[model samples]
Target chain A: MARTIIPFGPQHPVLPEPLHLKLVCEDEIVKEAIPALGYVHRGLEKLAEIRDFNQMIQVVERVCGICSMLHSQCYCQGIEEMMGVEIPERAKYLRTVWSELHRMHSHLLWLGLFADAFGFESLFMQFWRIRERIMDLNEATAGSRVIVSVNVVGGVRQDLTPEQCSWILTEVAQAGKEIKAIQSTMLSDYTVCKRTKGVAALTKEQAYELGAAGPTLRASGVAQDMRQLKYAAFDKIDFEPVVEYDGDCYARGVVRFREALQSIDIIRAAISGMPQGDISVPVKGNPEGEIITRVEQPRGECMYYMKGNGTKFLERVRIRTPTFANVPPLIAFMPGLELADVPVAVLSIDPCISCTER
Target chain B: MIENMKEITLDAVVGEASKMKSDGQRLVALSCTQLDADNFDIIYTFDKELVLTNFRVTVPKGSDCPSISGIYFAALLVENEIQDQFGIMFNGLVLDFGRTLYLDEEITTIPMCNNTKAMTVKK
Candidate 1:
């Protein structure tokens, strides 16, 4: 068995993010892996010191375009903690609605990419076409397709009008019905199951030991979702954290698909129950203290640490994204997997290198 | 319960730590900043539940804070990041701490520290 060293990315056909993994393969089986990060580090934490607290919201939103709303939400909560401000009821519901919408689109986009990676082109097209509804909702409400800077300290920047809310709910419900149909086909289809099930497997114990969070951890039978913390309006909504026990690519795919349904349910609840109140409150004084805020992004737990020295600019801002936590589990799962399955295996963790490196 | 969630500080956390391990609290993040020409502030976050306690310690010019890599493995890359961005060192990282971002062959000072000459390094 001659070992062949293959570089997976920094430029590869499958990855939508910049991550370099040196995969050592003995014939078709992976022997070992070494990951190289910092390729896309823009010194975001350093930049936060120079940017004012408000402007940094936009900066943090760019950490990863897919999870942009979550980043802004976490950042806003961190700043609010330091400043000791309470967001209005309406703002909380709006943030929850938008956050769930972002989750729906992100999971759909990943589903399409996963389908394309495994050469299921029709499924990929179907998911992305369905994703357009959520993207339109984002642009109409938040003013951007990718980096929706709706979150601000003490609340959100935009308010959802009644007409917009009604339209969004109708559109989202239709998208949800379509997603259920696609998911049923994906689950029952023999080719999709044969390609994914029992492949790139991580056992439940391994997942916990590696600190794998989000869907990867949930797929491995650990029902621990930071969403259980119920930040924003999740407590008021009816939803369950999707879980699967197999801990393979198929299980991960199932978890993500089911989670999208839960997101749809959350969006519907937020739309119907949204209260009328202020969207934002004026933040006063410098944040002289420290605050740690954690939110459940589309991928997993995204943590933020903020320290303010009573200044307009933050003294320091640190982000611990889900991709960072999931990388250890990814490295652990690489051994003994076939070379051809590497792309889907890596994608199974939903690597967002921008969020990881930032 | 609400008050317990608020007002998390060192004195309160130190009291809590006696019940936990010496470093039982999870290390959230480490940050280093240049206060003036030769002053530095290194802050570490220890969190349990929603409460976060911050430890801020200062070091003079050309000095570095003690590394907590022994306690938290994730601190390794963060130390490297702090070293690259602020020229601070964590004494026993046992890895290529700064090579991830800055690619200097043997330079010791942080590339982004105040009053430092620019290296062609991209951090």
Candidate 2:
């Protein structure tokens, strides 16, 4: 048997972002895959040195458009810990509400992209249609659809009043019902299950050893979610990580589908138990020490390590994105998969190249 | 939480990493911060049972730091990345891109280092 190398994409119909995979194949079976990134490497960490801490919030938020809110939230959390400022109670509740809404929209976006990857056009359209409602809510509340710059150092910039909260709750509930109606088809449809089930499977031990995070780790039955750290109002709210034991593509899909619905429930809970107070507090000085803040993003566990030097600028800002940790596992799973199944396995982890290269 | 961080020597990093691996701790992240022109601090974070333990090691410029990728294979990406962006040398990476993981050969200056010239802003 002879091995032939095939380049899988900096541009492909299935991938919305740039990720090049060099696949060594014997006929249609892949023997190895070597990934080449940096196509969209903007060097945001280096830029953090030039920009002050306040401006770096906007830069970090641009790390990934899909999970921009979480990126800023994680940065703000790190800064708040270093500055030693307690945000208002109302701010915590608002953060929780927006975080869940971000999760819902992100999962829906991934689901739509995953459907498109598998050639299920109608499913793609349906998922994106439901996702638009969340986007509209974001625009209405946060003033932006994708990169909502709502998170500030002390607290969030915007607040939702009672009328707006009611509207959001209604919208999320309707989205939940619609998602449930399509859940069986997305999970159990003959084409979807056949393409996804038992593909790119990783055991619990493998997932932990390989440093897999987020839904990818959850689908492998690891039950490790950074939300358990309870950074925001998660400690006050009732929550359990969504986990699936199978560790296959289908299991990952099931986890995200369930998580979207869970986000809806969480938003409702947080809004009903809303606290009355101010949304932000005044910050006096610069962050002087170092801290590591972890947030569970739509993809997985995103870690931010910030070291400050008692100035307006941070000495260092290192972001360990979920996609960066998830890439190695994707490489490990690729060697044993068929050439045709490569796209399915690749999309299973929901690779965000921008996040990986940022 | 600061008490949980254990500062270790560069020579002891490999041994300590192996112990954490045996204890079923996941490697949360690895970060490098430039201390000055001649020194850098490399921090390795690990998690188990929702508790974090950080191990720190300080190394001089151009020193060959022992790679923990052998114990935690996922360290390969971050190690390769640090090698590319910070010009830090890790002795034993499973997959060494030879400092081409994120940057090209034509770009010689390490972008993340303290002394590198700032990237020009296009007006």
Candidate 3:
């Protein structure tokens, strides 16, 4: 068997972001994969050192365009912990609404990209069409479609009125129904099943050992989610982490599809029980300690480690994104998979290279 | 929560990490913070049922820190990243990228370290 090496993207049609994998193959089967990052690295973590803690939220929000709100929320929570400020009840509920909305858009975006990877052009269009509702909702409420900078140190920057909340609930419910209809085809279709089922399967043990997180870990039956940590009104919300035991690409898809539905339910509940008061609390002084905060991003668990020195500028900000943790599992499962199945398996983890390289 | 952070020696990191792994603590993240001109703090965070436990180790610049990737394979990428950004050395990395994980070789100075001339200029 003659071995050949192929480079799979810093740019690829299937990958919406930049990630390079050097695949060594014997015939049609891949033997190994070496990943190269830094293609999209912008040194955001280093920038954190120069920016003031209050101003750094804006910088952190740009880490990943898909998970921007979650990043800012996580960083703000870390700073709040250091400052010891209690956020308003209304702010917590607002954060919940926007975060769940962020999750819905992110999962929908991923579903469309995943469909595109498998050459299902119509399915891709269907997913993106439904996702537009979320984008419109974001624009109407937060004043931006992509990087909704609604999070501040003590709370969120924006508030949603009762009418706006009701409108969002109606729109989300409509999108949920459509997603449910799409899930039947996305999960049970003959081509999707044949291409994904039993391909790039990771056992529960391997998933934990390789540090897989979020739906990637849940799909392997780990039952771990950062939302369970009860940050930002998650404690008051009623929801369960979606778990699938197959640990295959199909199971990963099923997990995200179900999670999108779960996000809708969570948003509905948060809105129904919306608290009253100000959306933000006044803050004073600089953060002067170190704290680690974790938030459940659409891809998985994103951890932020912030170290402050009693000054406006943070001494260090280390962002450990879900894709960084999930990349090893991608590399681990790449071998023993057919070259054609590589794209399907790679996209299953929902790789966000911008988040990874940040 | 601050009391939960346990400081360990560099030599004890591998053993302590393996013990935690065997006890079912998933490695949440590993972070390196520049402490001073020559000292760095390496923090390893683990989670069990959403409760976090942290282990900290402080090393001098250019010191050889043991790689916990042998026990927890997921540490490889973060370890390589620390090597590149902070210019620290790990003795037993599972997959050593040789300081090319996130930076090019042509860049001679570490970008994230506190003592880097670029960081000093920014300050």
Candidate 4:
């Protein structure tokens, strides 16, 4: 037998973002995968020197189109902690509503992409069909379908009116019902199960030590979620992480499918308990000192490390996106897999090259 | 300042990292901050049961920092990224990209380090 090297991507039809992996194979089985990034590296972290703490919120949001809101939320959370600004109750619940909506859309987008990876085009369209409703709610409330750009330093910039809140609840409930309708096809379809079950299986120990995050880690039964940190109105809402023991691609898909519905419930709870008042407060001074804030993104835990020097411009900002932490786990499980099955495994962790390269 | 942090020298990084790994703490992240032209501060963050423990090490710009990849395999990516950005060297990387992980070979400036006039290319 002879060994051959295959370049997986910097561009692949299945990949929504560019993540290049050099797959080394002996016959049909992959022996190793060497990953290469930097295709879309924008040096966003280095912009902290020029951009003021307030302006950097916009910069951080561009880290990933899908997980943009969570990125800014994490950034603002750290800035708030450093400045000792406690946001109002309404602001917290408002943040929670948008956050869960973002989470729902992000997971749905991944679900569609994951389905497409396995040649389930109909299933892919079905998931995306349910996802558009969530996007429409974003547009109606936050003025953007994708970026949203609603998080400010002290709190969120947008607030849902009573009518708008009721409408959003109706929309999410409808979307949840639609997603639930397809649960059997996405989960129990023989072809879907055949393509994913037991593929790229990472054990509980392997997932944690390799630094897997979010649904990827939870799918391995670790049950560690940044939402458990009680940021935003999560303190007021009830939540539990979705976990699956198999750690396979199928289990990962099931976790996201369930999480999208979970987001709907979280939104309902936040909106029902959402108090009236201001959505944002005025900031007086620049952030000084260091702080770390972690939030659960659709992909996983997104952590931002902020170092400020009593000036508007931050001294340093380090963003540890979920994809960056999950890459090693992707590599850890790549070996001993058939090269044909690479796409399903890669998409399982929901690789966000924009987040990773940022 | 990190809440659960202890200051350690560059030499003690590997030992401390081993203890974290033995204690079953996940490596949350390894962050590098440039204090000045001459010194860089590296913070290793580990998480267990939702709580974080951090180890801080301050090393000179030109020093060769030890790689903890042997103890915690996931540190390889973090160390490689630091090497490319700050022009620091990790002596024992499991997979050394040699400053080419995120940047092309032709791009010469260290993009993250403002104090450096040029990237120190070394083995």
The i-RMS of every model, in angstroms, reads: 4.4, 1.4, 1.2, 1.1
Estimate, for each residue in A1-358, the C-alpha lDDT of model 1 and write its tens digit.
7889999898888887778889999988899977877678776877866899989988999998999999999988778877779999899899999899999999999899999888899999999999999999999998998788898888988998899999998999999889988877778799899889988898986776555768998999977677777788877876777899999999999999999888888888888999988999988887777666789898988888677788898877878888887877788889988999989899999989888878
Name the weakest run of 10 consecutive residues (lDDT summed) in model 3 chain A. A41-50
List TM-score per model, in order. Answer: 0.86, 0.97, 0.98, 0.99
Tens digits of per-residue lDDT for model 2, A173-216 = 99999999998899889999999999999999999999999999
Model 4 is docked with a DockQ of 0.82
| Global lDDT scores for all candidate models | 0.78, 0.91, 0.91, 0.91
For model 2 the TM-score comes to 0.97
Kindly report the interface RMSD of candidate 4, rounded to 1 decimal: 1.1
TM-score of chain A of each: 0.98, 0.99, 0.99, 0.99
Judge candidate 4 at residue A183 and give its lDDT: 90
Reproduced native contacts, each prediction = 0.07, 0.70, 0.73, 0.84
Which residue pairs clash within candidate 3? none
Give the Cα error of residue A224 in candidate 2, in Å. 1.2
